[model samples]
Target: MLKRKIEIRLRPDGEIEAEVKGFKGKKCTDYIAFLEELLEAETIDSNYRAEYYEQEVLLKDENKVLESIEVIPESILKASNKK
Candidate 1:
């Protein structure tokens, strides 16, 4: 399992700043959209961190597909080449 955290800062000028962590690719934008609705806040500016360009990784249970050839890279290659 991966750890996810959101760091929020409230400035004296009534400004809200948030730093989202652990989410990769476009997932962060989804969170931002949620925040906009939840806080009724409009973003004045935006910036992308290094994590923005990374691929989103999904965790799956191995037992669910233990007998599936899709789990094996070599098997997938051989199956595709056969066609």
Candidate 2:
């Protein structure tokens, strides 16, 4: 079983930061798209964790595998968008 988590932090300077965990590959990005759009934020830099490189096997006999995945935390994206 795979678990998805999102952690959000508010800074003293009125900045928001978000961290995503347990999301494999592009799913993390897809999950946060709505938040980014809602906050009118743009992504500046992205760091993919080791988990992102992990490949998921859907079926053993079928040999079906998912593609490489990467995700950007919300807080990092918001910080970069600030100028």
Which candidate number has the best TM-score?
1
What is candidate 1's lDDT per residue for 14-68, written digit by digit as tens?
A: 9999888877667788988887887789888889776666554444754331221
| lDDT of each residue in 1-71, candidate 2, tens digit only | 35777777776986667777886656666756766786677555567676765545466678665444344
| TM-score between candidate 2 and the true structure | 0.55
What lDDT score goes with residue 32 in model 1? 83
Best by lDDT: 1
Q: What's the number of clashes in each of the models? A: 0, 3
Q: Which stretches of candidate 2 lie over 4 Å from their true place?
A: 60-83
Clash number for candidate 1: 0
lDDT of each: 0.71, 0.66
In model 1, the Cα lDDT at residue 80 comes to 96
